[model samples]
Target: MLNIADTLHGWCRAARPFALATVVGTRGSAPLPVGTSVAVDEDGTAVGSISGGCVEGAVYELCRQVLHDRGAPQRAWFGYSDDDAFAVGLTCGGELDVLVQRVDPGTQPHLAAALDETVQGGPAAVAQVVDGPDELLGRTLCVLGDTDSAHGTLDGGPADRVVAAQAGALLRAGRTARVEVGGDADTCPERLSVLVHVHASRPRMLIFGAVDFAAALSQAGSFLGYRVTVCDARPVFATEARFPYADEVVVDWPHRYLERTEVDARTAVCVLTHDAKFDIPLLRLALGLPVGYVGAMGSRRTHDERLRLLTEAGVTEERLARLRSPIGLDLGARTPEETAISITAEIVAHTNRGTGLPLSHLSGPIHRDRALVS
Candidate 1:
């Protein structure tokens, strides 16, 4: 899916009136998770995808209606059934609750600034009044920067203050949630539901090799919302021109660079440097880190040899067990690009605690819990 905030920022800068459709809730096996959005302009131009091509046409029509009527923020539902699947289709056999609203820079000034922050890869959150009174509908509260400072018209009032505090908490947690404000007999009897969408900085993907496969993996990692860094000891190979998609290029030893760099639970470390001089030391340190993944690329024989070397170096067996020796899933990949896909697929599956099984074979919900480690 395209970056909705970046696209919205571009359209807003061009002064194009548009309607933003966001999936605030879902049930069963919805293709996309909550917070996914698609923006449709008056000219019928659209960007982003909320359902992976499952219900764009119907959502587009809703956008047209919203723009035509200059309506209040409206919530619409689309379900997957044999009867309606052929009409307003969702092949995934799931249901979607979408909120569509007409947006303009003049009306949604805070949203415009939030979009700018998101486009610049800064952390921010946008809280929208999805279900509320007519005056509160479409009202937004945006919290920008790490300090959790609030910016928007949705402040000052008691209920609005509650929504802003909830949004800031969700932003700090780096997770999206629906918060209910008011509904108190003493304060306000009517309840309002605010959908808080957290926009954190992209996760980091540290590729330890600047080889032919690194180029492909860098592109794939960037597409998967990772700020990729291609690191190598050879300055000639670790040039920005080689891996244009990488956010940074570091000409340093793999293990040394990783030791000093900041890595969190969301970070992924892929040690594609197959050489023992590079892989052994790097894997030893990586296996002990708190990062999400640690994988080394090599054949079985090379893996065995590397393991022996690591064991002899006094690395614990439990730490050794953390390494994904063959690197990627067993996809029979031959080309560098295909190998990159296999590696990234494994990383994603590992990050989500998935079994790397095909969707057709899975019996449970296709979408996993969207929350990351706090």
Candidate 2:
């Protein structure tokens, strides 16, 4: 998918006018998640998507009208269940509230800068307050770098900081939140409401093995919107030709390689180097970190042997349990490609804590429609 933020930057640099539509809230089976953005240039060409094929046509038409009329920024909500919902609603039968703003150079430079930085950094989240009629209009914050400083102010003071802090935490968790400012000594919203758009680009997947399965897994991970890396001590097998889909091919020992890098709660590491010579040292290194997901691939007997070896190597039960050996959900996948799908599916399941059940069997709302990035 084209990076909407980059496209917006180009428009900004060219002094061309454009409208940005961001999904701010959702109540039902919305097609896109909060923070999903769509930027429409003067020509009506767009980048990014807010809903499926359901709402883009309407949003684009509205954007054109807004640009032509020089209209003020406003928030619009589309509910799927409305009688005429199909006319300008989410086809998924959900409701999504979008913040449509007309941006120019003087509008929110910090917001543009943050978006550009995030686009270059791959995928990150940007939070902005489009509402709070009393507080801030068009004020924004970028949250990927661990701190939440504003592009502008809803109202500066301890109250803003408190809200910013809370927004940053939610952003890191890849979620959006609507906050109300209470009565504080300095200033308060007095029942003011601000819509925070927190966008989480994608997760990073590091695979420590350049075997056949690793190549397939990299391809599979890419389909799930993961930045995949394949590393192996053997340069021959780790060659780019073997795994063209991997974003990075590293010729390095697993343990030494991970030591120099930072892995956080959003990172996933897969150890497919089944040999104890490589597996044990790598597991030792990975177990000490706070990575979101860590898994090792092997057959049942091999997994058992690895566990025994880890015990012999002084690995504790607490740390050992963290390892997802035999590395995938029980899909009984037999081929490398199928196995990769199972592994990637497990990653999604773990990230969202989703029940791996067929949708036809479920009764409640579909949690959220993840952007189908490939």
Best-fitting candidate, measured by TM-score? 2
Q: List the residue pairs that clash in candidate 2.
A: 125-199
- Count backbone overlaps in model 2: 1
Which lDDT value does model 1 have at 222? 96
> Model 1 off-target regions past 4 Å?
1-3, 10-18, 38-72, 81-86, 89-91, 102-104, 131-137, 153-194, 222-225, 235-247, 275-277, 299-321, 369-374
TM-score, one value per model: 0.76, 0.82
Q: What lDDT score goes with residue 127 in model 2?
A: 45
Model 2, C-alpha of 360: deviation from truth (Å): 2.3
Lowest-lDDT window of 10 residues in candidate 2? 122-131
Worst 10 residues of 1 by lDDT: 365-374
Highest-scoring model, lDDT: 1
Candidate 2's C-alpha runs over 4 A off are: 1-3, 39-48, 56-73, 81-83, 122-125, 135-137, 143-149, 163-202, 369-374
- lDDT digits (tens) for residues 187-263 of candidate 2: 56343455555556567799998888998999998888788889999988889899999988999998888999767
lDDT, model 2? 0.75
Error of model 2, residue 242, in angstroms: 2.6
Q: Could you give the C-alpha RMSD of every candidate to the true structure, in order shown?
A: 4.5, 4.3
In order, the Cα lDDT scores of the candidates are: 0.83, 0.75
